[model samples]
Target: MLIGVFAASLAFQAGSAFAESYQGLLKKGYTVGKMSQGKSGSLGWVLTGKDGKQFCKSKVSLAVVDKKTLVSILASGRMVKVDRATFEAGIGGPDPSLPLLSDLKAGRVGPQHVGACTPLRG
Candidate 1:
């Protein structure tokens, strides 16, 4: 019984460490690059940061209500239900007048957006 408990605790600790690693990647600023379509039409996305660094990326089965909204889970297990307007506004371009989503959907990947995430100053 003690051995089982120790193994379980180790598994939990490893899981937590994995989650922290993904969070650390996000804190470094990663942008969504490619979204792969699933067998059921669901989607998966890949996020890349500046200097070609890979951040947290995920694939999820999504249910779309409107043509403009997507509800899915992030790689970190965070539930994200985003609409076109919100997505566009939230992922604004360097000029704020342009949005990265528009370019992404149009097959154009741009530079990483500044201040996109909490700046890591350590």
Candidate 2:
């Protein structure tokens, strides 16, 4: 019965975590952009959000079996799981080279030449 209790507790915790992560993603305006299946059967997702002025993108890698309850790794090397508050808070920010969400909100980073994600070949 101890094993059963432990399993029940784990399920509850996972459910709570999933809920938090889902809410956070929604609050941060992330929508599913693309999905791909990895070789190991894990799922990969690219999350995209736009402020109507600029775009924010993140990639998440997770297991398909526990898609909802898994944490994803961002391209920025940040580990993000499905906890809405933390994800939202963590995602919508700025970098020194790129315009931050806060700056965009405040009308700081105008619709100008934001740098490209890739460098010019020529």
Candidate 3:
């Protein structure tokens, strides 16, 4: 019984995390711009809002398992939330603990706060 409960907990965690992807962002009216690699080896992305004004730009760390893409914010210098003109300007802050998941094969993204991009500037 203990083993079964542990397995269930793991499954639950996976389900909760396996959400949010490039396609998912598009469906939600977000435009994911080109992905660039910074000198620190982090992936940078500029996702614009539906109206094309506000955006979320941050250096991210990505992990690919099978067809799943797990991305975490590697925010280390001047984070922008949603109020900026240039896409890439600042760079000087501490790292964040936000994680987002995306499934490449199934094209699914998820558990509620998947689209959250707070405390970041454009």
Q: For residue 17, what is the lDDT in candidate 1?
A: 49
Model 3: lowest-lDDT 10 consecutive positions: 79-88
User: Global lDDT of each model?
Assistant: 0.43, 0.36, 0.39
Which of the two candidates, 1 or 2, achieves a greater lDDT against the reference? 1
Summarize candidate 3's per-residue lDDT along 66-104 as a digit string, tens digits. Answer: 222223335442223431212113434322333332331
Please give each candidate's TM-score: 0.33, 0.22, 0.25
Q: Using TM-score as the measure, name the better of candidate 1 and candidate 3.
A: 1
Which candidate wins on lDDT? 1
Model 1 Cα lDDT, one tens digit per residue, 1-122: 99999999999887554433334555667555554433333333344565353332232223333547655544344446667566657657222333334343432433332112222222
Give the TM-score ranking, best first: 1, 3, 2
Q: Write the per-residue lDDT of candidate 2 for residues 43-66, one digit (tens) a residue.
A: 333333442211222222321223
Highest TM-score scorer: 1
Q: Stretches of candidate 2 above 4 Å error?
A: 21-23, 26-122
